[model samples]
Target chain A: MIEIKDLHKSYKMGSNSLHVLKGINFNVEDGELVAIMGSSGSGKSTLLNILGMLDEADSGTYVLDGIPIKNLNETKAANYRNKFLGFIFQSFNLINYKTALENVALPLYYQKMPRKQRQEKAMKYLEQVGLKEWSHHLPSELSGGQKQRVAIARAMVAEPKVLLADELTGALDSKTSYEVMELIQNINDQGNTILVVTHEPDIAQMCKRIVHLKDGVIVKDEKVKQVRAKVNV
Target chain B: MFNRDRWKEILEVLTTNWFRTVLTAFGVFWGILILIILLSAGKGLENGIRADFGDIATNTMFMWTRSTTKAHMGLPIGRNFNYKTEDVETLWEKFPQLRFISPRNQLGGFGGNNNVIRGLKTGAYNVYGDYPEIIQQEPMAITAGRFINQSDIENKRKVAVIGLGVKNELYEAGEEILGSYIKIQGVNFLVVGTYKKRSGNGNGEEGQKEIYVPFTSFSQAFNRGNNVGWMAITAKDEFPITSLKMGIVNEMKRVHKIHPEDTRAIGFFDLYEEFNRVESLFGAMSFIGYFVGILVLLSGIIGVSNIMLIVVKERTKEIGIRRALGEDPWSIRKQILLESIFLTIISGMAGIVVGALFIYGVNALLDANGPVDMFMNPSVNLGVVSAALFILIISGLLAGFIPAQSAIKVRPIDALRTE
Candidate 1:
């Protein structure tokens, strides 16, 4: 479970204070697919970044599995991010030079696993994403859908409790986007909690819950009907 | 968690930018090469200088009497004086420290003066009377010849050892002068040997025009009448020869039966004093050479350091990636530092080996051509070479210090942002 309360973040841009995130509260439970909805400048990505431990909040009480994250330093936050939460950025963020399997092996480099074991585990995860035949292809050689599948494989390989994906389908066309949503639905069904940030309501309607934000404030948080997975058989 | 994996990362980075890596290492390579060449050249110069002075004999002392008198041997009052055979003998036997003795009879003895055979076919020549022991005092090389021996002196045999110049002028070209007869001062002396002149030593025509004979024979035949123009000597050991010079002076007084206060009867020179003067001059020159060598080494080291700085600056991004991927700062620092030291050691060895081979090459070439004089088989001492290698390693560290420190200081956030 992940929990946040009274999150406030700000930055000074040449003497003018930019309020990137205002006060807010949010939560994600086991096996939930939640969507964070906002338009541009709505603090959705900033909020996701703060929750993913990629950036810090100026003021907040973050409780991940009942442990407070506000006091965690950079290294410790990275550690927590590695162990408890997996991140997927809008761009897929695969290191362009690495193959699919090697990209899946990124977090394991920090896990201190032996090379052989890490490769085998990464291969297994790639197989689960149905991209096992493309394991040796670099991101540039893979389609947008295939690259996102590789990123999801990498995020899920570590068995983290929370998958915080920021605009996971932002760069894919409609068909590829549905395929990615279907893959995300399958992953969440496997008992991982996912919090995806996107601007489109059609994408948000696919999740079990939706959290709407306006100027960094949580305007609404409500349970929604689960849309059936519509990826091609 | 890190260990050798960090090295793998570094190797990846190096391979990714292969040209940059080699260029960085080339800086160290060039530094070592220049260092080695400079050092070897300095050694060669010192050797060459010593060779030029080889004939002058580093440990020898020469003394010539200035003419001063009230009619001791000639009839001039308070005129410059010269030595006599009696004075030489007295000096040789009395001063125990005087190892070898040679007293010049006169300067106008020989050289281009034709010894006429039948008053028409004149063979131009020069002759010197020297002891066999005098050969050991200088680096004199004998070619197809022999020096005078004790037997020649005992028999007073009329024989001469001619230089190449004398042999060429007297005997027809390409003719062997050994066993040939040469007439000198109305006397036929057998040519027992032929010697080549030493050009590397700074000795003037005196070295070229030597036609040496048994000293006793020359002393007797020339009607020298105990008169010598100058004398040279070596110390029994390396101790100062001043006291020994005084001992000779006292002996001279005894031989002439003159009172100690009767200084007007004879004159002497302190060649040891002259030798010291020349030695001090060389000492100063060698000091300057050493100073210049050290300065060159320091500049080479600076070049290495500057190269390392550039390498660190260029690789900052790669350093960030490594640290982000679970690499400890220590490992990053170690990899960069090891790369630097390894580069220096390899290049340093290349320099040293090439430098050493150069020395040996010159030694063999010179030993074959002729006598090498002071420059023969010039070599750097083994201990000194090892010390130089150690200095190279230390120079690597100094060159890489700032870069390695920067690698360690790379913050993961800043590095990733540099993405």
Candidate 2:
């Protein structure tokens, strides 16, 4: 479902070029739950942003669902983000002015969904995330766990081909974090491709597979066994 | 988010930040207020000056002989030329533009000292004979009875209209002297109507201390042999009073068989020149008032721009978040732009409504009291309101466009990363 070949990103800080992402090659198939784990400065967040179409790689070949992502312009890339991509951020990234329901329905704005149907779809996704009762509350009015839940709901509402969770449970307590992971695992089981970036070993263990990155390169790839492995498989 | 949704967002921004919004609105509100008030005052002053000229048609040109030191046709320098009735008729006959050029024959104290009214009235009155057409050329809208009619002139009747000052001395009230009899110079004459004296007034020249009698009657009764009264000539309105006076002077020379160099023999007051001078003064005053109003309004608009710049700066983080949420640059631009337009419109409407109400209150008061006694009907002009409203809308758009475009240029990544 995704491919990256010779991807490169550089920054010019005053005098010289600092290459952040060296040329690399990677791939992940459909219905796969892949976790990319690395220490700080490993470019895990930058890779997730590039995959989610939020930022551009300086030199790279990125193919997503058979579409070559590099040749797409800004407007087209934004359109692709609307139709095939969704994001879950560490800080939630929900608009503070909006209620949880409206925040979740935001992606539907790009699809031109009429307001009533958008709200209904947003409500269903909030229910799926077990936050149906808190769907009308603003981000500021919600606790850390509730805010992440709403963000998860927003990510799931569009039913995109790929869900990129960037430190989705980083801001939650362990109990709430476990609850959120279980919800994400359930979402993966429902047949959507999932990618998560995290620094925690336990968080990586929750996924079916883990790719270890070091210094912007993939150092190791391993298949993991979960506590409730294949329970419903 | 075009109209309804855009406005909804604007209302949220405004209601959530009411104090900031009101501060912005105040600038526009006061601007419109000053504009409307100054304009209304300008209109009032203009009307007052016009009324100062009074109801007697000052625009009518007179060809009364001005006494001169020079003589014509080699006559002695000290000799005076009298404009006779024959000369007045011959001049009028030749010039078709002479609407009414009749000799102003007076029957001063013709009723014998006005003692007929006993000691109730003073002897400060005169019975002046005028052609029936003379009053029509003037601005006197008769309050009750008609002016001197052709029949009164042909029959030399003793009927007359009393001045407001004469009415005060005789009948002592309004709309009542239409039937009262007044003894002018000891002769009993019926008052056909009472002329309204222009308000806040003094001096008899403005239709006070006088009575109007038919020129034909007064001429027969009081004009002696070879007695040619002053020529009370009025030009047709289509003709300039100056040109008409010149035309009449040329024709009078032809009739009197005098040379063109005898310009000193004739004297006249050109009311058109007087009207232009006064009108130009009023025009300058109106222009200055508008100039000041616009200057203040421009400052107010600049103030609005300053405050909006501050608002954009204060909301940088909020704007960055909105931009990153997949909202287009246009949406950001539109949101801030709508906020500004809403602020300006709200404040402008408030100012205009309040200022209009104030002016309306004054107009009502003035109407109840009557048009400016010296100036007629100095009230609010709907034209001025329309002009002001147009300026307000243009100012609204002008003051909002630049700051909002600046908002659109703010990069989301830069804004979000700004510590």
Candidate 3:
């Protein structure tokens, strides 16, 4: 669950400041799958970044699971991010030196889990993504869809309260994108709260709710008619 | 302390870029190797030079009379002079600080030869008529009997202490030669002892060719008169014997009636000053060894630092991922620092091992060949080597510092943004 009130963010470019996000307000409830949609410079990514706690909103009240995420120290913020949020980047940022299983186990390692149990739990998540057979494979060795799957496994392995995916299927083929969305949909059905950031209408429709942004402000919020991903062979 | 996962990570990172690792390590390897070798070689050089002054007490001063180069007080230039037995007594009374003062008289005075004979066996030797104190100055490893004693000098006894070489030449192996008679210059003298010089100036055989007789007996029998060829005096610990030599020389000038300003009137050889000179020479050599070693080590550590900088740059993404995964800045810093230190220590250890092996090889060669010119028994003290390793560890940490700071300063957002 997340809440924001009058969030603002700006970027300084030499002599001028670009107001990226201005007076944005949004919310997502428990177990709700939401998609935030906007074109380039529309501030959807900025809003998502603020929600991910990777960037601070200049003037806003952000509440995630009843804790006001404001002005936390670096250490406390990192701990909160580790405990409460999982992130999936467009590029599927799996450390190239580590195998898929090791990548999935990384967050658990920071959690101070014993190496053996971490690997076991990572293997379980890998199996959940249908990637148990490729656990030992490197990210470079995997296809685009499989890499995204590995990233998804890594994201959910820690079982964080919120999952934030920024353009999760942006680099995949349409068919592979459908499969990744189906996996995300399945994860959301298991009662995990998820937010997908995408500009694609079909991907936005796959979520239970869609929030549209323009000029750094939310323009529309509506319950979406869920379109299930057709699982191809 | 041994974490298998951390070790696996380090090994993977290092092995993935094996070429760069070895290249980086070479700097430290060569540095430590040269450091050890230079130190060991310096030790060898010191030992070799020290051997040249073997058995001669460092505090001993050899004073001999020479021709006067400048005349004063009615003494003409080019006047030859010699110290006598009475002067030795006078010197003793004047300077009681002279612990062992002995006037040495060789065959025909100085630079003379005397052939020793026992039955059909004969060996040529440089004979010395010396006091019992001579044994203290140039220690002899007595093999058979006693040396020249007070009674022999007082009574002018015809007793001789033959050298080991003389004993070997004249007597059969295991022969009872002590108390036996030996003929020197056709004069029969009873062999009171057989001795060998404990050390030599790179020539053990030469030391073995010497023989000692009572000074009184030598002066009386060889008609040496009252003329002493040279005087050797070893002072009681009040040293920098150069001042003592000057005092004695000035005293001799007053007693012997030579000119005070005549520099060439006495051949003053200060063993303490000579030893000091040699010591300072070796000190300079050691300083140079350390100076050059530090410079090389500096460059090597700099190489390590440079490589660590590049490594940090290359791993920015991985570091960002770790940060995003909730790793602290301190953890990132520690990781980079550990890697740098590991590289230095492993490579440095290898260098030390190889350097030790090389030194061992040199020592083996030296042993096989006996004492060589300008080099002997190259070795490094364990404490020094251990201290060197300790210094290397600190260097490793220092080399890692800047790179680790760079790693710590990497912003998670900026690094993640880097596609």
Candidate 4:
């Protein structure tokens, strides 16, 4: 569902330029669960950003779902991001003022969906994430695991072609982290293509394939023995 | 355009800092209130001043003869001359623009010794000899009997129109005044009419104490021999008497053989010129009111703009999230602008309501008491209110412009990166 060839990106910091990504090639088929692993400043997050259409690469040939991504204006890029990609952030970036259900319905609101249908669809997603009873609660009132679930529900409600999770469980405790991982695994089992970006080896192990990055270049690409997350609830 | 979600979002964001929002709104509220109050107060002053002119024709001037300052045609300097009855006909023939020219003669000056004796009720008063047209120039209501008409002047009838004050002084209360005889300086004349002058410039009492008699009978009785005391002349509506003053004076100077440069030969009071001055004063007052009111309103708009900028800055993260969720840039900009406009319009309407209430209260208080001098019926008309509303809408747009620009300029990635 995604393709990238010879991707390169650089950032200008006053006089000196930092090359974040240099000549990287990657591909993912439909329904594959991939983990991009790297230490700090390895450009793994940068790759996820380009894949999610949040940031453009300085030089690349990238295609998603048979559509090439190049030189799109802000409006078109936003539409593509909404229709083709979902994102889960480490901070559980739920709008603090909106209830969990409203937050999940926001993407559909931008799509100009009718309000009644949007609410119903958002409720269905919230139920899938096991947060039906908590949909009326705001993010501030939810625990770390529940907030992450709300964010996941929001990301999944639009049924994007791929999910891009950037250190999704980094801010949570280990027990909560496993719970979120189990949720992600369950979502991946339903044949949704997903990309997880993390430095944690245990988190990388939960995926079916791993791509390792070192100093703006891929060091290893290997299939992994998938480890299912065990959760109490 | 009419989205409930958008409205809900605006309400939520604005109420987040409700105290600051209220304080920001007060600026616009106070500005509109001050503007309306200033305009209405100016109108009130104009109304009060205009009322002082009363029913007297504003386009009229009163000219009287004075001692000449220069000698000409064998006439000595400082020779006092009187206008003749034939001079009135000359003026009418010379100036077709002149509407009415009434030559008047008076006897027994305003504080003169008891000039009229009537059944042991003697009093000092001023008596005037006037034609029928003089009533049109210096208007008064004929209360009891008829004013002097053409028949009285043509036949030289010895008849008089007594004022209300004259009636009160000469006759007892509830006594018949019309068709009665009052002897003026040993001449027995019949009182035919009674009048009341409308109150003007604190002179209503003095005006009602005067009396009018036919010009022919007065000249005959007083042995004035075609001599005119002073003339009250009114010009046509299209002509201004002030502009025609010098021409009339010069013509009179020529007729009486006085020097052309004898400025003191004929003294005059131009009511039209004075009325014009008062009109320009009103215009200046209104101009000043608008100038100061707009300055205050401009400061208020600036305050609103400043608050909007702060609001956009505070909601940076929220804007970023909305943008990332495929909210178009125009939609984000529209939300900020909508919020700003809503606040401005609400505050402006409140100001208008409060100003109207204030004017109503002031009018009620004035009604309960009596009219105040130089201020009456303070109010703003519908046009002014509509103009204020238009200004509020434009100010809302201006106040929102910069902040809305800043909001749309935010890149979703950088915004999402911000805490």
Candidate 5:
């Protein structure tokens, strides 16, 4: 579902330039659950940003769902992100003023979907994430686990081709993190391609495959026995 | 563009801090209120001043002879001259631009010895001998009987038109006034009419203490044969009396054999020029009203802009999330602009409503009491309201412009990174 070859990215901080992603090659097939593991400066988040089409690489070949992602303008990039990719940020990133149902319906709103249908679709996703009863509550009113579930429901409501999660449970406790992981695994079980970015090894174990990045380069790639998160939850 | 979701989002964001929203709105409210009030007050003052002119023809001049400053054609300098009855006919035949020329003769002064007496009552009063057309030039409402007409002048009838003040002084309440004979300087003249000045300047009370008699009768009774005191002349609607003044004066100078360049001779008052001055003063007042009102409104718009910038800053994270959720940059910009415009229009409408109520209350108070001097019927017309609404829309756009730009410039990635 995604492809990246020799991707490179750099940031200019005053006079010095920091290379965040350098000569990285990665690929993931459809329906695969992959965890990208890294240290603080390992360039894992930068790769996911490029894969999610949030940022562009200075030099690379990247394709998602048979469409190459290169030199796209902001508007087209936004459309592609809406149609083909879903994102779960560490901070939940739900608009605080909107109720959980409204937050989940935001992507469809941008898609120009009719309001009635958008609400129904968002409600289905909220139900799938086990947050149907909490849909009317705001993000601030929800627990970390419930908020993460709402974020997951929002991310999946549009049924994007790929799901990108950057430390989705970073702000939650271990118990809540496991609960969110169980939800993610359940979603991936339904054949949605998902990428989880994490620094924690236990979280990485929950995925079917692991990709390790160190100092802007991938050091290891392996397939492993998937540990089902619902068993722990 | 008419999206329910967008509207809901705007309402939610704006209502989150309702106090700040109301505070921001108050600026525009006060601005429009002051603008309407200034314009209405200017209109009121114009109306009041215009009312002082009353029904008198503004395009009229009152001309009288003065002592000549220079000798011409054997006429000595400093020679005091009086315009004769023949000079009135001479002017009428010479100047086709003149509409009405009324020769007037007067006897007695207000503070002089008592010149009028009836039944042991004696009082000092001014009496004017005028033609029939003088009523059209210097308008007054005849309260009883009729004004002196052409038959009275032709037949040399001893007829008079007394003012309401003269009537009150000479006759008791509910007494017979018309056809009654009153003695003027020991000459009995029949009272024909009673009049009151329509509008009061400062001399309204004094205007009611005058009397009018036919010109021929005054000349015969007073032994002033064919002599004219002064003339009230009105020009045609197409011509202005001020422009025709020099022409008429020069003709009179040539007829009376006065020096052509004698500036002091034939002294006259140009009512048209004075009326023009008052008209220009009205224009200046309106200009000042607009200038000051716009300045105040501009400050209010700037305040709105400042508040919008703060609002955008406060909602940066929210904007970031919307952008990340595939909201178009234009859509985000539009949302901010819509919120700003909505706030401005609402506040401006409130200001208009309150201002209208204020003007209504003032008018009601004025109606309950009497008319106030130099201020009447303060109001703004529909055009002014439409212009204010147009200004509100444009200023709303201007106020939202900077903040909307800042909002759209936010990159979702960087914005999402902000704490």
Candidate 6:
């Protein structure tokens, strides 16, 4: 579950202040699959960054699982991010030097898991992503689709309550994009709370709910029939 | 801190850039080597010079009579003087601190023409008349037979201890010279021993060219009266030889009736003072060696610091990623610090091992060859090695500190945006 009310964010460019997120109110209930859709300058990316706690909002009252996420120190904020949220970046963001298995194990390492258990847990997640055979390969050696799958496995390995996908298929071809979307659909079917941020209408149609933003404000919120990803290719 | 994974990561990073690491460590390596070598070489020089003075015991003094500069009692200012045999007894009675005093008389070379000798062969050579106590002051190795004893002095026996060089000149090599009579100045004296000086200048061979005989025989045979050419004196262990030397100088001035202010009258040489001067000079030299060594090592440490700074800069992206993964700032700092410590220890230890081997080679070479003037076995001191290890640790910490601080300051957002 996630709750946000009157969230505000701004950036200073030279002497001018650019308002990125303005007076936004939004909520997502438990186990819901949602898409936040917006074109460039619609503040969708800014909202995702705020939700991921990677950036501080100027003014916000955000609650996740009944805990207020405000005025937390760096350690507390990092702990919360580790325990409750996961991120899938458009660029995959896998450390180039580490193998896919090691990348998946990284979050568990931060959690202070023992090496043997961490390795086993990381392998299970790689298996779930259908990448068990390719777990030892580095990101550079992996295809775009495989790298994104590894990143998704990494995001899921920590067992966080909410998964945030930020244009996860932006760098892939349409067929690979559909395959990744199919994976996301399967994950949502297992009752995980997820938010997909994208500008693509077809990507939005794959989610059970969609929220549209225009000029730093949400313009539409509606539920839709989810389309299954055809994996014929 | 004891995690194996942390060490693994550090090893990976270092091995990735091993060539650069070695280049960075070279300055420090060379610094440690040069420091240890210079210090050991300086010690070797001091050891060699001290070896030359070993025959002259630390607690000994040599007093030879010189002309008085001022009138005292009935003696005139330029009055030439020679000590008599009675003067030795008188000096020993005057100074109870006197441990062993030998009234020495010499013939040939030092005062006049060398005596012509006849034995297995014939040659001219210097001869010395000394009491048995002279052996305690400046020792010579007796090769064959024995030195002149107390009975030789009491009976005024014509017994001689010929030097090795004298033996070589007057007799065939490996021939039996002991108990064979050698005629000196037409007086036949039985060869009692053959001797060689242990250490000295102008080559130790010079001392091996002389001969030793009992004082009474030398005085009686040469018709030199009761005159003593010079005296060698040593004090007991508990006494300060310098004070005794000054007392003797004053006493000699009183007996010879020379002015107390006339320093040249007695012509005394206090070996203890000379030894001290040489010791202090070596002390100062070692101090300078360490001072210069530290300066060189400091520059090497700075070089390490500069390289570490570059390494930190290059890893900004990796550091950011770690930060984003919930890694603590201290962990980043620790990683960088450990890498630096590893580099310093590895390189510094290599230098020490190489330096020790080099010193070993030098010492072996010196041992195989004879001791050279002002130099002997060169080797590193244990204290110097301990000091070098301490310096290495401090250098490691000093080099790592700034770079570690820079590494921990990386924010995830800015680092992620770097690409």
Model 3 C-alpha lDDT per residue in residues B142-215, reported as the tens digit of each score: 88789999999999999999888877778899889888998889888988998978564656777787889999
- Estimated TM-score for each candidate: 0.65, 0.80, 0.81, 0.85, 0.87, 0.78
Q: Candidate 1 clashing pairs?
A: B67-B80, B67-B81, B68-B80, B68-B81, B83-B228, B84-B226, B85-B226
Candidate 2 on B354-417: residue-level lDDT in tens? 9888888887888788665544444557787778778877776778778787776666545555
Show where candidate 6 strays beyond 4 Å: A1-9, A17-37, A41-53, A57-85, A161-165, A185-197, A204-233, B17-111, B115-139, B146-160, B181-190, B198-200, B212-262, B270-304, B349-378, B381-386
Report every candidate's CA lDDT. Answer: 0.71, 0.74, 0.87, 0.91, 0.90, 0.85
Worst 10 residues of 2 chain B by lDDT: B110-119
Off by over 4 Å in 3: A70-76, A230-233, B59-109, B113-136, B143-158, B164-177, B182-188, B198-209, B214-270, B367-370
DockQ of each: 0.12, 0.23, 0.50, 0.53, 0.60, 0.33
User: Which pairs in model 5 have colliding backbones?
Assistant: none
Ten residues in sequence with the least summed lDDT for candidate 5 chain B: B1-10
User: What DockQ would candidate 6 receive versus the native complex?
Assistant: 0.33
Give per-residue lDDT, candidate 3, residue B397. 94
lDDT value, residue B363 of candidate 6: 86
How close is each model in CA RMSD to the real structure? 7.6, 5.0, 4.8, 3.9, 3.5, 5.1
Please give, for residues B300-400, the per-residue lDDT of candidate 6 as tens digits: 88888888888889888777666666666777788899888878878888888998899899988888887677897776678889989998988889899
lDDT of 3 at B391: 72
lDDT of 3 by residue, A63-144 (tens): 9999999997767777888888899988898999899999999889888789999999999999999999999999999999
For every model in order, the TM-score on chain A comes to: 0.96, 0.94, 0.98, 0.98, 0.98, 0.98
Model 4, residue B143: distance off in Å is: 4.7
Candidate 3 chain B lDDT trough over 10 residues, lowest sum: B107-116
User: Where does model 5 exceed 4 Å of error?
Assistant: A65-73, A189-191, B36-47, B70-103, B110-114, B117-119, B131-133, B149-158, B183-188, B214-228, B235-244, B247-260, B286-299, B356-387
Worst 10 residues of 1 chain B by lDDT: B116-125
Docking class of 3: medium
